[model samples]
Target: MDASDGHADREWRLIREEAWPGPMNMALDEIAAETAAAGGPRTLRVYRWEPRTLSLGYHQDPDTVDWDHCEREGVGVTRRPTGGGGIYHDSHGDVSYTIVAPADELPGDLVESYHELCAPILDAFERMGVPARFAETERPARHQPACYLRELHPAHDVVVETDGEERKVSGNAQHRRTDAVVQHGSLTYAVNAERHLAVFADASVTPAAFRERVTGIADHADVSRSEAVGALEAALADWADATEGSWTGDELERARDRASEKYASDEWTRRRPGRR
Candidate 1:
């Protein structure tokens, strides 16, 4: 992949941000997608959640979350642009990554793009000596309120088999606009699985029941957050013609503006943004 024969060195930047509020993270991801759509270089962004947050799917019912519980627990609240069950990220405990690229760099279809985009995560797990594979079976229709409690969908996440059972280690979701795709996922270093279920009042998601289905890297192996990030960084840079760069002033401003105007706003988070 040199700069010739239509295989030019595709310039992309890798950003490692300190833990940020959920709104900021969502804003930055949207900015990345806008940049890519407007013919900018691809961007790979990684960071952790500060003020630990629970993010709902863009169209997920806000009523699904226990507002009283969230307020009492002092957890942050926001909604992702992608659709899926709500996700709970422990404060400074999960390694989250987002990739924003032009459609040309990804498979046009959503399902295919999930597998293609998730390869780096699978690669990272493998580099850490973890035998992770995609769960190739379609998900059964169960109305679970949290992703960890929901059944695994084919290639929706990276999982490892243990104790004759498969447990998910990472989960990803994507949002695509005209000519850009933004995919984000979390590789959990550790988590209090029982605590996460508290945000949702789903009767079926009990600690003793769903905890067995929820496992992270720390649960199965000695992998550290830095190790996972490093492996993913190498895989991503190799997968694309990424160059080391930082966010420009304009980019940061736009992200902040987006955060305040959309992600952090009641109109967006309280309900489906622009949903008919």
Candidate 2:
């Protein structure tokens, strides 16, 4: 069940877990890359946040958020190891995914690598009867504090065509290590653009305008989390040699340590690290 089985079969170990808090979720994703780099199974993990939370990018300033709104809603906030804009993880409306693989298994070009990892996700959307496609043109950077508020990354988004317009459905970020690559993204079942917009400081986009830029899978199909995961598994199976798997006790312990010592730590989350 390990990648050391020679490159004869590109076996992807899939791990699916229930909703967890922001710190644990982010820590486990880091562990996914570490797991692969050490010659363990390359993994794909899918999970969500409990009680919901707002996850900021590695370099983002927490002070930029409208903390007043976050406190009122009882939402926890933490930072992601990956770089990107902040995202609102709604337990009821979002499903998140993490992909870990040997760097050799992905494209050397970062942009092309985004396309490579996104293929199975696009297939998963298609299986749900949504005709999702990659953004054909480059999107001008938004520099907005929030993720859904930003324009699509020409290479990173999964968009669905609607009435002659292409609306993005997901936002992703990846990190390349010496021997492995880790990418994490979120797919929404519904869009609560208003609630998401409230947390960002001085966001000019209104709720009505925000609705025009993003779409959810529920727009095209209604499937439970398990069903959506099954679709992803089917799609990944088509892309690489894959198998279902579980996490070990040590991975759990390491992840907890990472969460408490890094992700949930004020010093780590508050200050930006150099180059990931």
**Considering every candidate listed, which one attains the maximal TM-score?**
1
Cα misplacement distance, residue 1 of candidate 1 (Å): 7.7
Clashes of each: 0, 0
Show the lowest summed lDDT stretch of 10 residues, model 2: 1-10
| Clash list (residue pairs), candidate 2 | none
Give stretches of model 2 more than 4 Å off. Answer: 1-8, 139-143, 272-276
Q: Would you list the clashing residue pairs of candidate 1?
A: none
Please give each candidate's TM-score. Answer: 0.91, 0.90
Error of 1 at 197 (Å): 0.8
lDDT tens string, model 2, 1-276? 234533327656777556788999988988878888888888887888986899998888776688778879888789887777888888767878888888887789998889878877888898988788887755554446777766676788778877877777888889888788998888877889888788777777788777777788888787876687678767765555567788899999999999999888778666654634
Query: Of the candidates shown, which would achieve the greatest lDDT relative to the real structure?
Result: 2
Name the TM-score of candidate 1: 0.91
Residue 235 Cα positional deviation in candidate 1, in Å, after optimal superposition: 2.0
- Across 1-276, the per-residue lDDT of candidate 1 in tens digits comes to 344522136668878645788999999888888888888878987788888889988778887888888889888889998888888886545788898888777777778889877877887787888788887655553446687667887757777787877777788988888788899988777767667878886656557666566667777667777877788787776666577767778989998999899988878877843573
